[model samples]
Target: MKKKKGDKTMKNLKKKLMYSIAVSTLLLGTTIGVFASWSGQINVQPPGWGGSVVSWSGVTKTSNSSKFAISGIKESNSLDPYAQLVNSNAAAKSSWCAIRQGQTTSVNDNTGVANYIYYTRCKTNNLEPNSNIISYSFNPY
Candidate 1:
């Protein structure tokens, strides 16, 4: 017996649904870490509210293939980085802190940006407690 037009449409819809599911599953499964450099330190949060970490920036040097990295950050070089983040938001209370290349502590000093213009450079491991400054920045979301 010939299939009805409605039945054919339903069958087509079912096939499309199955294909979509299969493609999604395959894409997710095959994506077992095809992105290498993408595994770097990347974490962006809202400005926050009510003691929810208004805005905290982090910078660290990634060591090894996929493991612990040096937390070297200095305050002397916190000028541009801190200012960079603050400038992005005129009403941002930008606070800055850096961890040592291999240690976890504020190396140089703490920088603050009570008000900003529109320039925030979000780069990590760009400086060290006992080393020169490393410059890095990114686009503000």
Candidate 2:
């Protein structure tokens, strides 16, 4: 049987449509994978301080990548307080690094006493292959 000219055009159009759909699906999947992220908070306290001095530090996985970021905000009466990010694994203790030093500000409350608040900068670090867990330390130094 002889094929009409329109039949050849229709066949080429269908091929192009299928290719476009397949490419779109693959790209969509990869885009979603790259943008996925997770986040959590850990309560931390400065050494020698009691539970009343504890603060929640924010931590987040940087968009499904092997990296994470941390930030801390604490209310204290100390000078030069800061936050540090460290690998939770004991073997990786040497990997600890100071993330940020607090930007300090003093405010007077109803008691007329000076209250100091520490707002540390957010910092990011790469995840170690065997140390996915992260711990934070708030130091009132």
Give Cα distance to truth, residue 114, candidate 1, Å: 50
Clashing pairs in 2: none
Worst 10 residues of 1 by lDDT: 45-54
For residue 39, what is the lDDT in candidate 2? 27
Model 1, 31-56: lDDT tens digits are 74333212233232212111112123
Put down candidate 2 lDDT per residue, 1-141, tens digits, no spaces: 999999999999999999999999999987764443212344443343211122333222222222223333432323323233222221111122333324322211111111222222222232211211223333211
Residue-level lDDT for 123 in candidate 2: 25
Give all candidate RMSDs, comma-separated: 13.3, 15.7
